[model samples]
Target: MSTTVAEVPDAHGPTPAGSDGEELPTRPTPRRSTLGQRMRREWQMHVFILPGVLFFSLFAYIPLLGNVVAFQDFSAFRGIFGSQWVGLQNFANLFTDDEVLRAVANTLIISLLQIAFVFPAPIILALFLNSLIGERIKRVIQTIVYLPHFISWVIVIAIWQKVLGGAGPVAELLDLLGMHGVNIMTDPDTFKVLVVSQVIWKDIGWGTIIFFAAIAAIPTELYESAATDGAGSWRRMWHITLPGLVPVISLLLILTVGNLLTVGFEQLQLQQPAVGADAAQVLDTFVYFRGIAGGDWGLSAAAGLLKGVIATLLVIAANRIAKRLGTGGIF
Candidate 1:
């Protein structure tokens, strides 16, 4: 008598009795909505971002096309398209120009000073504010800090002038004390320091808002657990708070490095008369004076294009370093 055999599944379907038990592969179902259909479904979300998208396209991306002037003997009379192409001549001039090089050097020096001093001031302030037990006091302090950020640069500069200029209160105090009063506003040696101080005083509070928010977003449980384990305030901050702020810090650092060459056009331009271009000349002012005032369109455009390229590369390099360090980057 033959033994009863069980049916076995195979590649296609259930196999006949005594067949192998290999299973069939199933095909993935096609997605129900096409990309267009999906976009249409989320039309409102797209609408929400449309204005921002359009604004950048118009002001940022569109202006990028003008960089072609960097490669041409650009003339206002002939216009960008009518201008004769000069290949690398403009770039050559940019690199060889003494004023451009000087501007670049000044920009680097000022930017480094700002990064070293101004960058960390907000974080320190944020930490101090965060550590405060009284919410009402913290709110009042934050408001005071944030107010300067809302003040125009012109007004801020005026205030600084009134407080630290040759005849200002500090100088007056020095005069009363029988010490020599210094004109800080026009002193080239101290211009970089003045710029850094202004940046810290004006934007430090606004900068703290982000760091404070980041600190607030950190879970209280982490701090509570650390405290339960007998960790003191400094230990808790070092272990929990700073680690939580790494992502935000990394992001801001990347942005700061990327903008190393910028160094505040309006602020620098306004102060140039006081300190003179020898000390205050930066890439932005160089471009403004060379292109707008001196009518050296091609040269200025080349300088700007170079600055933009360097800034873009800095951002890329910074992001890469951040990723390697295991911190979240802007990318």
Candidate 2:
């Protein structure tokens, strides 16, 4: 007697029956891992993100908790928990202070000036450089310009002091020419000019990188096609290069608006004594002087909190405006 094997049918779907008319064997259902097992599988990815998560939590979120100091009369002797709650007193102090108003005024004036003068400079510079024929020379010039960005603000200011301060080279030249030696470094009258110029010198090169990158990303075929259509370098740039950079420009503009009040704390702080708070007082410096230096923690924290809130709103408004204007927004 010969025996025959009969296959069982698959449970998921129909399958061919055996000669004995039995169904084929079905595949087993797949089982999902538990939450713990799933987490274990992604352990490497979690490890990679852990350090950054810790850093942000410590440096960013932890400090944000200190903003509570704005609501309390904070003192070293009386810690955060021990401080007396003063509700809106700190905020009130900010509104009533004349120096706070002056600081805000100075910050806005200088930042707007920077936006007007310094912002578009790199775009122009990049375009000019892009139009040049020699790649090696372009690279060399880019490197030279970008070098200043790496220099510390302290050193940058010191160098400016040497060049523009009284008895320095520029002042000495003016003195020798029978002109009154004006102290650019310590002069309240010229502080805005000095700060703006320093900002341009330090950042213009760094800013050029983005514009240059944007310009470079434009297709060579576009330029070739434009040339075929009787377009010159200037024409091609006007039509192609500038349009390509519009997105980046718009994005940076929005960001700059957000940072308008963030006019250099260290820069102003370093120069404040020489130029006096009247000329050099920006919001950041005011916070440092009043909060950290003078030990008025509550008032400083309140002022800082207000500044941050305003800056955030400005960024949101700028982003919305950009989107409405048909430009890419930061979000």
Per-model lDDT: 0.92, 0.91
lDDT of 2 by residue, 1-331 (tens): 9999886657865776678989877678899889899779999988999999999999998899999999999997989999999999989988789999999999999999999998888988899899889999999999998999999999998999899888799998888889886788988998898888898899888999898778878889999999999999889989999999999999999999999889988888899999898999989998988988999999999989999999999999999999999997999
Tens digit per residue, CA lDDT, model 1, 1-331: 9999875557675533333656545558887899899789999999999999999999999999999999999999999989999999999887788999999999999999988999899999999998899999999999999999999989999999999998899988888888786788989998999999999999999999899889989999999999999999999989999999999999999999999998989899999999999999999999999999999999999999999999999999999999999997887
True lDDT of residue 196, candidate 2: 89
Worst 10 residues of 2 by lDDT: 7-16
Clashes of 2: 6
Off by over 4 Å in 1: 1-28
**Clashing residue pairs for model 2:** 7-23, 8-23, 8-24, 8-25, 9-23, 9-24
RMSD (Å) per prediction: 3.5, 6.6
Evaluate model 2: give its TM-score: 0.87
